[model samples]
Structure formats: C-alpha cells, structure tokens
Target: MSTATNANELKITRVYDAPVRAVWEAWTDPAQVAQWWGPRGFTITTHSKDLRPGGHWSYTMHGPDGTDYENKTLYYEVEECARLVYDHGGNDDRPPLFRVTVLFSESDGKTTMDMTMTLPSPEAAAETAKFIKKAGGNGTWDRLAEYIDKTQSGRESFFITRSFRAPIDVLFAMWTEPGHFSQWLAPAGFTMEFHDADIRPGGSTFYSMTNGQLTMYGRAEYQEIEKPSRIVYTQQFCDEQGNVSRHPLAPVWPETMRTEVLFTSEGPNETRVTVRWEPCGEVKPEEIEVFKQARGGMTQGWTGSFDKLEAKIAGSQE
Candidate 1:
C-alpha cells in the first residue's frame, strides 16, 4: 500500500501584445523582466536570474507605497519557445510555493499563454486568489498577458519604446562614457555635470545639477552594463560631493534609491529608453505617501527634458 500527497491549484490565462518570441524573451531576459513584471505601481529589481532547471531567480518587488517584497523561485523546467515551469513558493520561504507551468502557443501571428499553478495546500490556493495584488497566481497570469502586447520574435526589448529623438548611435555612445553624459541628461531646464562618471559594472558616478536654485545632487552605482543596450544602476539623492545622502527636505526619504535605465534602438535614427526606480533604504508609510504624490511632478520634469533632447537631436543633424 502507498500513501498519496495531494496539492491545490490555481489557473489563469492572459493574451499578450507580443509574439511568442518576444513574450519568451521578456520572461527570460533580466532587463525585459524588470520592465513589466510588477502591477499597477510596482517595479522589479532582479538580484539573480539564472533561467535553468534547478536554478533560482531572486528579486525584490518595489511597491508604489515604497514597500519592498523580496521573493525567490526555483526553475523546474524550460522548453525553449514552448513552455516554462517552476516551483514558486519553492522560490521563497513562503508556505505555499507550488509548481507553476506556463504554455506559449501562437494564434494569428500572436502568442497566447496559459498558466497553471498547483499549490501545496488549499490554504495556499486561497491565498493566491485572495491576494490579487501581490503576484498571487492570478496576478502573475495577468502580468503575462500584459507582456505579450509589446513583444515579438526578432524584435528589440520593450524599454526602447519609451521614445527618443536622437540618432540611435549617438544616444548609445552618450551612455557609454561620462563626458558625453554631462550634456543634456536632465529633465529640461536642468542638466547634469558629472564630477566623476565611472560607468561600468561595479563602478559609480557622482554628479551635480542646477535646476533653478533647486539644485540636487545624484549618485548612481552600476549593477550591470551592457553597452549600447542596457545600463542598470542604483540612484540616490546625494550631497554636493555626489555621495549618497538623505534628501535635504525630507529626512524620512529612503537612504538610497535603485533605478535601472535601459536604452533600445528602433531604427538607425530612433531609440527607446525606459527608466525604473525603487527605494533601497527603509520606507515609512508617511514618506511613501508623500513620494507617491510627488511622482507626477518628477514625470513632468523628465518629459520636458526629453522634449528638449528631441530638438537638440534634430538641430544637430540638420
């Protein structure tokens, strides 16, 4: 006689805007994974992503409220261009990590994916359904569906679609060195001049700015650097010397903010740049609320700066 172990399950389905190839890359590539891996107001910071059987993927999910959710997962199976399976709760110390399988198939030049998660227990399944926000089984499926919308086989990464007016090669070069970066890397009416721009994996940059008497200093530490394609760095408000420091106005602000910037080339002359940021230090509820409120202003400032960049690019070429 043999004893049997039973486990619970949660299933979800989502259609993507991308092709099968792009969808697959998004799920596998570290840079692509960071772009849309989170929900309405969350971003991913991958510490380690080794996609292979018995390997593990670990990362922290940053919430709009400035909270950090650390996670881990174990890869069970991978069939290139076909499927991905992993034990998620096995991914972390969480109680209900289970086997999750995803199937990717093509329909009318589009890719459709189906996901099935077998939980360790009924309680875990209940957790997946109830926690619709935090990468519960259902939430993960929803994100997958959103991913397909912008990906395609043989196409570029998603970060490149954020819009760029400069020639692809020019923008690519600017990111590789510190001297060129000092030109127009700000959010309009503000420019960054690096005191030191050591842009390499494990290197750092310290820069000063003049944004209309609202001069702010920033420091960035590169985590990974793939020249002409991606640059992942942790950014923070800094002192005049470009050392990471507490925000002058708010002591409660996270001590360090991690941000990843990726640049993609559309054509010889077009480029796409995506920037993602998260808190690296402790976050309190009140500070989180205030930071959320201030995000809009920051967006406006960046848009203006990019707008100027477009003109600068045009004038130089003409």
Candidate 2:
C-alpha cells in the first residue's frame, strides 16, 4: 500500500491479498472492523452501524492512553464491494472534518483499495497529514492489512508506511547504496558501518551498528531487488564474523526475519515506502509471540530511522 497527498486531498492505495468479497466483508462487517479499526494500541467500539446510503455508523475510538474519541460517519453512497462515499470525523458537537471516497477493485484474485480524503483546503489537508503521522493514524491501514493477512493466509507480520519527499529512484538508491544506506539506517544516536555490502538479488550485506557502549552486528541476505520498486531480504542478527546468531538482548527473537519493502511513486518527487516484516524460516510459537509483542518497539525503532532518513534527504536537497 502507498499514501500520497495532493493540494486538498489525502490519498491512500493498498492492495490486499484477498478476494474482493472477503475484503469488503472484512471492512463492512462491524465485528471484523472492530478488531483493527484504530491505530496501533487503540481499539474501537461500534455503537451503531448502518451500511447504506444516508445511514450512519457511529463509534468511539479508545486510545491507548484511556482517551475516548467519539466519531460518526454518514454514508452518501455505498455500492456493495465496489465503492463508498462518506463524511467522516463528525460527532454531535462538530461537523465532519472531511469527506472520504473509497473505491475497491479486484484483479488476479487480489483486491485494491483506493481511498481519498477531501479536505476544505490545501492547508487543512497538510495539517491533517501531520496530525495523522504524529498520531500514527496510518497504522490503522497496516492493522487492516495484518488482519486480512492473518484471516486469509494464516500469516502474521508487521507493517509500516512512510512517504518521503524524494523521487522513487533516489529513495531506492538510499536503500541499495551502502554509502547512503549507512548514513541513516541506524537507530537514533547510533552509527552504522558496512563491512561488505552486496545489495543485489542473491547477494548480502554485513553491517554493524553502535552507540559507543554496545555494538550489534547483522546480515541481510537479499532475495529480490527490483530496481525502484521492491526489495525482499532475509535479515538475521549475526556475529562480527558473519555467522547467524540470536539477538543478545532479545534471546527469544526470531532467528531469521523476512523483510519486504515496496516503493511506490506518489508523484514525480515523492515516494511512499511500505515495509512488511515477518518470521522467515521455521520458527517456534514463542518466537512468533515475541515478534508480535515487539511491534511497539519495532515501530519506534523504524520511526527513529525514518526521522534520520528524512533529515538526510532534506540536507541533500539543500
């Protein structure tokens, strides 16, 4: 999935590995929607859901910090399994913040969801985009993807997306070029150095990251590298000598994890990157549980890296 923003609208497009009917049911069915309706660490209570033109769906979003936000959506148009148009972010006290139009289509047994939130002005749209990022609102879609993946394929994974103000090719180079990758791919306050980097299909990279006190070594074995579009790799904690090992602090972490990164061009100068992570080879139940439980930390780590990446890109532009 990818997200983009125009002058007065926020656009998001995602492809789900499920049939159109299944995707529609997962979205329209209140029972399934409640499971992944809010951002990470948030839940929702659907008070009343009437999925029809002129009907209303009311709910309360419960934040992680015990904050409850009331929301109401009035449907203007609803075509079963095809499209939806609704006014969202309204309650008894206020009017809707924006109008949303979502279109769903299926091809090759997979469903594509395209959604646009139309705001009143470009400034309003920009502000909303900032608010969504600050609140991790985008995680809601990732959660939806996870829900569908689990239900349809019995697979569990972690997902995150970020839109960068850089061309798709530039962003792709930032990942594949070791010199650029090491500049911002480390956790906050840490530095990364690659011993040997072969970032191509069937190749691998060995790198170490440190923050003065402790250093961690890892290896990424590239499985697929489609220029300017996608990259698939298997990552594992390893010794300085390049031998696979378990994380020193997280002994129960999965021995190997598969990472898939998709880069989509939002515009000529903007790109959206979506990353999915899951246990790669045979893994035990405990490892999977640890992976699931570490989502919050994973989010934080990736966010920190992204912050640095953003700064680096800004510096380059200047």
In terms of TM-score, the best-performing candidate is 2
Model 1 whole-model lDDT (C-alpha atoms): 0.65
User: Could you tell me the lDDT of residue 160 within candidate 2?
Assistant: 82
Candidate 2 minimal-lDDT segment of 10 residues: 1-10
What are the Cα lDDT values of the candidates? 0.65, 0.91
Poorly placed runs, candidate 1 (over 4 Å): 1-161
| RMSD after Cα superposition, model 2 | 1.6
For residue 134, what is the lDDT in candidate 2? 88
Candidate 1 global TM-score? 0.49
Candidate 1 residue-wise lDDT, 1-318, digit = tens: 001123366554444556688778878998888866765457889999888887889988888789988888778888987989987643445643567788998787677666777776878766765575233223333344434433433222121113455665777676666765776578677777888877889998888887778888888888987777777777788878666677777787666666566665544666756555545556666666565555445555555665566666677779
- lDDT of model 1, residue 252: 74
lDDT score, residue 86, model 2? 99
Model 2: per-residue Cα lDDT over 50-139, one tens digit each: 999999999999999999999999999999999999999999899999999999999999998999999999899889988988888888
